[model samples]
Target: MRNALLAISLIAVFAFFLYVAVNPGDFGGNTGDHLIFGEPKYSDMDDYFIHNGQNQTGANNIVTSIVFDYRGFDTLGEASVLFTAVLGVGVALRLLRRDKNDE
Candidate 1:
């Protein structure tokens, strides 16, 4: 019953997002409303990154350039966190299995 409810909830959420993407104006109440959610009013920063990211970072992929060059430290921290979590999980499971075998 819980799984069924979760599946139904997931489907409803996906359908809502699909409807919003297909008919954004319906959710916005206007075709060009920019108060909360609509087309971006300012894209100068994004434009600059796209145009100069390759040359500035010497990376052919703009996304990669931004992630590894502009936000290298942030990405490194996230990777470190993920590695630590996986290591912890592995150690904990190994100790648990060892305890079960000894008992």
Candidate 2:
């Protein structure tokens, strides 16, 4: 009984994946909201960064300007979060190893 239930669940998950792969654009609900694969959704923000990023940030590289100047706080927050996660994992592993050695 357990094996049969597991097989059914696996088949259902596989069918969901296959459906998503076949109709990637059907997620938006509306007919006009379909997104083409591999094409970027261009917005006014993109244009603004491309045209004025250098002038505003004084950085010759557009990517650098956006990361450091336009989104500096966001980037800093992401780095902090990543660092905390790594530290947490290290502490957890060290404690586990110590406990194993004690046993």
Candidate 3:
């Protein structure tokens, strides 16, 4: 229970960083009309698909390709960041790497 709370708190801190990512000009005090987060408006590329045994490229599924291949570097970075955070928590809580020779 305590560990879950700690994890949630850490994630909240990271999510709050989005304040810096979203410009004030983007929101402009209009709070009720649209979403504040995510892909900025769900572009067309998000809905692309395939045909008989081959996928179409004229519509050029940039978003799909990015999430799967070209942007995989970023994905790997995100995974590493999560791993680092969990490892940090484990160390902080003394859940791992304890010195066996110590009292």
Candidate 4:
């Protein structure tokens, strides 16, 4: 019964996502912009990055320039979080092994 309920719940969640993807405007999407999938949204920030990211960051790759220069602190925080998670997992594994050996 639990497995059946889980299956039904998963199916319902997937259907909800599918509905949202098909009719995004129904769920707080901008009705004024009729751009479909794969269409680019032109913004001043995007224009600035495309034109001046290389000059500002001195990086050949625009993506690298944006990640390392524009969002450096945000990237650093992400790396810190990932490092913490890895350290936690290592500590947990060591504790588990020590406990098993103590038995």
Task: Give the distance in Å from residue 102's predicted Cα in candidate 2 to where it truly belongs.
Answer: 0.8
Clashing pairs in 4: none
lDDT of each: 0.87, 0.88, 0.63, 0.89
Off by over 4 Å in 2: 1-37
- Find the candidate with the highest lDDT and give its number: 4
True lDDT of residue 42, candidate 4: 75
Those runs of model 3 whose alpha carbons end farther than 4 Å from true positions after fitting are: 1-64, 95-103
- TM-score on alpha carbons, each prediction: 0.59, 0.63, 0.37, 0.63
lDDT of 3 by residue, 1-103 (tens): 9789989999998877776666445643445756665336655554533331124333355556555565678998999999999999988668434653354
Which pairs in model 2 have colliding backbones?
A: none
**Local accuracy of candidate 2 as per-residue lDDT tens digits, 5-49:** 989999999999999999876443444544644355668998999
Candidate rank order under TM-score: 4, 2, 1, 3
Candidate 2 global TM-score: 0.63
Residue-wise C-alpha lDDT for candidate 1, range 1-103, written one tens digit per residue:
9679989999999999999898766553445535445555766888999999988999999889989999999999999999999999999999989988999
lDDT of 1 at 9: 100
47: Cα error in model 4, Å: 0.5
Instruction: Please identify which of the two predictions, 1 or 3, would achieve the higher TM-score against the true structure.
Output: 1
Q: What is the lDDT of residue 49 in candidate 3?
A: 31
Poorest lDDT segment (10 consecutive residues) of candidate 2:
28-37
